[model samples]
Target: MTYCVGMMLDAGLVFMSDTRTNAGLDNISTFKKMTSWETPGERAITLLSSGNLATTQAVVSLLEERPHAHGERDPSILGVPSMFQAARLVADTLREVIAQHDAAGQQADSAFGATLILGGQIKGGPPRLFMIYPEGNFIEASSDTPFFQIGETKYGRPILVRAYDPKMSFEAAIKLLLVSFDSTVKANLSVGAPFDFHFYRKDSLQLDTTGRIDADNPYLQLISQGWGDALKNALESLPDFALE
Candidate 1:
């Protein structure tokens, strides 16, 4: 399990993902969950994934192969004309990859199932975000909902709902995501560190930041410690329930 979010903001796009994959109590590992493809000026596309690691990785590999498969050196996300088409291409390719794997009798539906949060911008457009399902269909994020999150979601969604604002600074947006990730990490062991995060400013057409955040990241430590202590202090200061 993991937690990955892609926020579509007026300023740009913010993406964050955890690198944990757990099979059992003793079987756990870390692998990157964020992938990006860009043409420097033409367009940029990012994929943040959660769920069956193999299936997600296979799908991503297939996406990267479009150009080669098409007998061209340049058919790719960066070549796609719009964020919409790029997402469709990802969904279609995911469906094909998963279906083929299932047909080979080498995997289970649940084991090959995965989900993605896709986001970025094309030359003439605003940033956009989409949630691609295991079935390879998806929906776009709108201003009414400026962000999309996947995996271990129920635990972390509330913070995003509360803190996400289109006008908020990019730094604030990431802080909000960290708070959200922290809450989920405390409640679920399947999602662990190190985390993958990337920031893409609108029209920049380059990765602003692509890095790993480990269990001991300073900001994360502060939130996990300071916030928990603050909550405890707040609860202790409140009147206790009367024994009625």
Candidate 2:
């Protein structure tokens, strides 16, 4: 299991993903769920994946190899003319990997399935975000749906639904995400730190910020502790029902 989020904002895009992969009690491991592609002054793209580890890894490897997989004549993600095309390419590749796995004696409905959140800016287009499903279809994020999450998403979705702001600064966005991730971590054992984050600035055509946050990090500690206190205070502040 995993938890990953990608938010589309006026400032750019914000992404967060947990590193924990829990196969079983003794098989837990940490693996990065975020990947990026960059061509300075041309384009920048980031992908957040969750689900079957083998499927997601294969998708990522194929995308990384796209440049060399085909000679100069092949149009790789870096050469795609628009963000939409880049997402389509990702979806296609993911579908292919799953198909190959199925052909290799795995059942069509095997556990080897994955989902992805793709967001980035192409040179000629504004930043865009998409949630690519295991079936090779995807949906774009819009003002009404400005973010996407995959894998164990329920625990953290309300925070985003209630407080997301299109005009929020990158810093504010990150703070919001931290609180959300913290809430999820408290409720679920399948997700844990060190969390990974990436920020892409609009039209900058470069990644603006990237970092890992662990359980002991001071600011995260603040958010986790402070949010709990705030919630308790809020509940107390509300009027209690009177016995009739």
Candidate 3:
């Protein structure tokens, strides 16, 4: 299991994903769930993936290969003319990989299924974000739904709902995401750091910031401890229920 989120902001886009994958209590591993592509002044694309590791890796590999595969009809994410088209290409690739591995072919519940969050900007269009499913369909982020999450999402969703502000600075957004991720890490062993993240400033057509945050990072430690203390204090300050 994993946790991944992509947020659309007025300032730009922010993405983060956890690295843990496990088959059982004894078989745990860390694999990066974030993949990105950039063409400097032309485009900057990042994908956060969840679900079957093989399927997600295959989808990404195919996307990486297609641009250089001569006579390929489908453009790579890098070659796509717009973010929308790039999303379509990713969705198709995800569906194709799942179909190859599952007899049922493209079923969302198939053992080989994967889900992806695709976000970035192409040269001619405004930045965009999308959530692509295993069935070759997707929906773009909009004013009404300006963020996307895939995999182990329940534990961390509430903070994003209550605190997200589209106009918030990148610093603020990253802090918010850390708190959200900290909550998930506390609740589920499967979703944990070190987390990987990317930031793209709108129209920069290049990735602005990218890094990994290990469990020992001082700032993450601060957010985790501070948020817990704050939550406890808030609960204490609330009016208590009394049985009459």
Candidate 4:
């Protein structure tokens, strides 16, 4: 299992994914779920994937190979024209990969299947974000809903609901995401460490920063601890549960 999210903000985009792929007890391993493609000052795109490992990997590998005129050989995200076009290509690629895999005798149902969060910008357009479905369709983030998450999102959604604001500055959004990730890491064992974060400022067409956050990282620890205590304090102060 995995957890990956892409947040669209007035400031730019925030993408994050946990590297842990928890198959079962004794089967855990780290596999980066974030993929990036860029043309430096021209375009920057990032994808966060969740679901079947084989299916997702095959989809991405084929996407990188999409440049044979039919967009079947480009291979990576770096060459797509616009963020919207890029997403369409990603969705189409995912469908093909799933069909090809299962057509040869593998289970590839759309439910409990792979999904992706795609985000970034082209030099001429504002940064945008989307959540791509297995069916080769997607929905973009809007001013009313400036972020999207795939996989185990329930654990972290409350923080996003409480803190996300379309008007927040870049730094503020990062802080919000950190808290959200911190909450997720604690409540779910299926999602684990070595988190990947990509921060882009709108129009930069270049990633401002990308880094791996592992366990024992000081700032993440602080955020986690603070959020835990805050939740406890809030619960303690709430009116007691009423008897039936």
The lDDT values for all models are 0.84, 0.92, 0.92, 0.82
Deviation in Å, model 4, residue 125 alpha carbon: 1.7
Count of residue pairs whose backbone atoms collide, per candidate: 0, 0, 0, 12
Q: What is the C-alpha RMSD of each candidate to the true structure, in Å?
A: 2.6, 1.3, 2.0, 3.0
Local accuracy of candidate 1 as per-residue lDDT tens digits, 1-244: 8889899877889999998888987899888999998877777789999887888898888787775565566446656788898888888877887787788785544568789999988888878889999798999998887788889898989778876788888788877888888899999999887778888998897667777778998988887778778768978999999998
| lDDT minimum window of 10 residues, candidate 2 | 66-75
Clashing pairs in 3: none
81-182, model 4: which lDDT tens digit per residue?
Answer: 678888988998888877776677656444336899988898778898999988789999998887898988998898898778877886777678778777
User: Model 2 Cα displacement at 199 (Å)?
Assistant: 0.8
Score candidate 1 by TM-score against the native. Answer: 0.90
Q: What is the lDDT of residue 19 in candidate 2?
A: 96
Model 2 ranges off by over 4 Å? 69-72
TM-score of each: 0.90, 0.96, 0.94, 0.88
* Ordering by TM-score: 2, 3, 1, 4
Expressed as tens digits, the lDDT of each residue in 57-125 for candidate 3 is 999899899888988886777788989999888998888788779864545558897889999999989
